[model samples]
Target: NYLWINHGWMGKKVKYKEEKFKITAIDGGWSKWSPWSICGKDCTHTKTRTCDEPAPSYGGRHCSGKDTIVTNCTGGLCEN
Candidate 1:
């Protein structure tokens, strides 16, 4: 919880530098990634995650980076 109190000044204008209250920005967060799709046919698989874990709001920036990844599999070297 945050507490803020302002005193005095019934008819006065305060500059930005004089203001004591501040608004903090929030950053976005991502949820756990889904299991990689069974590497099949094309020997390729995919995994994904979303930013809904903590969707950006209140002037916050959206999560950066890709939400999905595609990986290529190989013989005798398939992902465990």
Candidate 2:
């Protein structure tokens, strides 16, 4: 409990605590995509990339659509 008086004027005193925090924003970077995988069942090929190039850090944004990608290859007929 406290009070402040200035020029015969009285006012209630307020208490406050100060806080400090640091935040660094980093955008994700991607590495080169690996070579296409050999055709597998259904003649499908897969390729993938990683964020290790500069992986997201300290609440940084992740690379958009960083998921694995599967593509169809020619002459890859699935044999029952």
Question: Which numbered prediction scores highest in TM-score against the true structure?
Answer: 2
- Model 2 misplaced stretches (Cα beyond 4 Å): 1-23, 75-80
Residue 68 displacement in candidate 2 (angstroms): 1.6
> How much RMSD separates candidate 2 from the native structure?
9.0
State the lDDT of candidate 1 residue by residue for 43-63, as single tens digits: 788899998778887788889
Global Cα RMSD, each model = 9.3, 9.0
At residue 53, what lDDT does model 1 achieve?
Answer: 71
Q: What's the lDDT for residue 4 in model 2?
A: 40
**Per-residue lDDT value at 20 in model 2:** 64
- Write model 2 residue lDDT over 27-56, tens digit each, in one string: 788888889887777878888998766888
Clashes of each: 0, 0
